[model samples]
Target: MKRAGTHRSDSERIDLTVRDYGLDGGIASAHTVRKRRIRRQTRFLAGLAILLVLTAGGIWLIKSLSGNTAPTTESSQPTTRPSATTAATVTPHPTSTPVPTPVPTTTKPQLSAEERQSLLQQAGDEVVHYLDQVTTGRIGIYFQNLVNGESWAHNDKMPFVAASSIKLGINTYLYSRVAAGEISLDEVLRYDNRAYPTGDYEAGTGTVQNLPNGTELSVRETSKLAITISDNCATNMIIRRLGGIDAINPWLNKISGIVDYRQKVSYTNYAGQSQNGRHRTCARDLGLQAVRLFSLWQENPQVYAPLIEDLSHTEFDFGIKQGLPEDLVVAHKIGTNGAYATENDLGIVFAEEPFVLCVLTEMASAERARKIQTDIAAIFYEKVASWPWP
Candidate 1:
């Protein structure tokens, strides 16, 4: 008998379904055939029932599990979501890339050769304005700073009949001689009446005759009086002691860098001299002289310190020193014979930014000249206050 619940080939099944014949063909063994067919049918029905039960159990399990799970939403695509803590721990790209920027090269602007000349020409415009104001009488003026560089009015080339201001040259020369050991500052210098010379009344009657009877004074005292008070007698005495105007020439040449710095003794004394102040000076050169004096203070501190310190001792405040702040020092020398005719002040005006002024004015009246001096000084200080130095 064929085994029940076993797979049978199609040919075998068909063969089993047909009645098989024994060698003797009687009825094909009726009882044997019936029993074999019944067993095969029972095995097939049991397999079908077991297969249906298994299918139904599998569907039930799937549906029951799906009911307890999260519902599917439009936004819930099948993707792996990272934990919030894990996302927070991750580093992110910077909003902007850290690109290396090329450093900017800074180059100072260079002025063309012509541009330098033009700058000076522009400064000249202001000079011309003042020059126009003093057209009535000869006008001279200049300005500069060793720190500030050079600017001019009738510079060294344009000579003015330097009046008492010439004492500046004399004093500077004498100071140099003393520095060189040619003269002793303590050496007593005598004043012979002949050493004093007389000039126009604008130069004045002088004060030499007023010196104490046959009294001798040291070179130091006389220089002080000559420079600080502009005593004409004292100046003449020093000039003679320094070996006359000729002795001052070599130094003057070196300083002025020109041959025109001539000194002709024009007075016996400067004290009480009418101050004809008519002594002429280019506006610019006088200013430069003042600057040079200040520079000397800087260059030879030991030698010039006292002199510069003593500049505050200047007695005349009517010129450039007028109207300036009281605290600021003005080391200046002023000259004017009468009113607006000729007025000049050469010296350094110290403020935050110090500068030298050499202004010469020959105005319509001495009063006008004085007024111009005051006005110009005020204007200059105002302008300098705005300068870049401070």
Candidate 2:
């Protein structure tokens, strides 16, 4: 019985062993199939990755060549505006060019000669009425409209003491020489007491006399002093340099009919004539001088620039300027000889309608003369302001 049992166990063991071996072989075959399937999947994934890389590279190269990396907004389908209702529609408006508006121009009023003469006569009568109130002294007035050339004169031919107004002739002659290039404005001049002796130094408007002897000044500087400050010493020096009244008279007469009946240098030995006769100028003549000077300045500004500039700096402003608006400019010169009781102002008024005025008074108080001047200026200003055009 023991031998038979042992034999049975050995058979059972052999059968179990064969079954185990079969199971192991089946597992090995299944593992080999799974490895093959994995390899095939890996190869397919790699090929797909390569295809994607090549497609991306081609797209990048095309964008680089075209220089257009910005995203495009192009659509394959046509777009339509949003509508509240499906049946709603839109219509485009017609386009057209616009026309500009035209601008209008201003025109000036023209007056007849007879009308102008009548107006001038009316102005003269008004001025005469104003002068009638002054019972004490002789007054002369000359006025002319620079634009229309209409003029009026009241005792304008009567001569008065020129006083510092003679400086205007001196200045005109000096500039005339400059215009002719006979003398240079840059020439240096010595102001010695001997040249304009201390005895000849008049005690009036000036600074050149107060300056030390042997002081040097250019012709231009001396002229400026003569005109702007009515520097007596400076005037004498210029007159001496020009060779006295004889040298200046011919030039004055030759140009602009400006007649100075007795032209004399200021603060000189020969300047002490009678008050009636010392350096006399008529209102008409002085007015003409101012007109000529303005014309000269307009014609040759380079030569007359200094004279115009000097006149613009007139230190005395109690005459025509007092009556004028501050905005207006008056290029003027005032002459007052208290010894002779003469007061005169000649100037070009740069009003809307410019004019020349010369007011000469004798035997009147300074205040009265200034009042007459201011009134005369106001009359002209009113006339100009009321004029129809600029």
Candidate 3:
């Protein structure tokens, strides 16, 4: 008779199934079948071993009860000693085989590359539509996902009055040099005509002017005031320390990857030199500035985190910040020139999906600029926050 539960042609049937699956698939199926066969063989051998041990014990018990261990002989020989117990000796159980651990699978679902690109495209459309509906005059925007390399821009290369946004570059250059040990924070700089090479004196949006001419502040204090209060005097102090616009502009261009970052121009400093802020920057370049600073902070968080901290506490809150949630932390610098009708904000937003965003607008009044900036920020933040980021 054939086997009670298994057919004689089980392997043959499995072979037929593998052939039906085709050459490529047959290899995978065969691998699985071999593993199953090995496991079954291991179990069968263990059971066979237990059966033999039991059978031997049963025979020994019968001999011991019948008193028939040794065969009868004509001459008596020396008898072997008996084990002291009346019961038969039994075999111990074998240790079990360990099962291999399975690899863990990711719990969260992931988006395909095409899907991610499609969604980002949709976001860009929404942003452009919003701009068409509301904004007027020259406007430029740059946004980049820090998590992924995907980016979006609208007129990002267009030049705009840098206004106070240059503070981002000035302070970043200062912090980077300080980290590299090229400059020290304790070094004292004076607020005088030296900071204003074009006979400029602090007059725009800071408190350093209130301290009077020739007021000496440490590089640390000046850096703090320049960012937090948008202090023009403090900014000039930093600019002078970095060797002024001629010295600072090249470094800014090289690191920011922009041709025109902060070109030198005549503007009023303290004591009524002139009444215009002439520094120039654009949206994309400003975004690069923030991105580079983010890299520095990543390299040595302790050394660069203070700059982020200072950016978080800046005085102006009407531009990009006006759109974000109040609870989240946003480190940014604001630049404005009511005279030139230029307003801008540069920032690193720490969102569910963090990003660098820079928005620059010239010829738009302060009120209109605020609305345009905050609204665009809201739209982008929604898009980034909704992504199923890997």
Reference-based lDDT, each prediction: 0.60, 0.75, 0.75
lDDT of 3 by residue, 1-390 (tens): 767877648787767786665445556866776787899999999999999999999999998978875776654754465455523553544222111112222334377656766777788899899878876667889998776657888888766678778888888888889899999889988778433665326677777777766788899898998899888878887887887877878777886644365444443322333433336677888998898888778777767777888887777777787787775567888888776777788888877666888988765467887888899888888887787745
Estimated TM-score per prediction?
Answer: 0.58, 0.66, 0.66
For 44-159, candidate 2 gives per-residue lDDT tens digits of: 99999999999999999998978776667866775685545533655444222111111112335366767766777877778888888763677888898776778888888776
Clashes (N, CA, C under 3 Å) per candidate: 20, 0, 9
Ranked by TM-score from best down, the candidates are: 2, 3, 1
lDDT of 1 at 246: 69
- Residues 250-285, candidate 1: write the lDDT tens digits: 665565533244533232121223322323345555
The weakest ten consecutive residues by lDDT in model 1 span: 96-105
Which stretches of candidate 1 lie above 4 Å from their native place?
A: 1-135, 154-158, 195-208, 257-259, 263-281, 338-340
The stretch of ten residues in a row with the least summed lDDT in candidate 2 is: 96-105
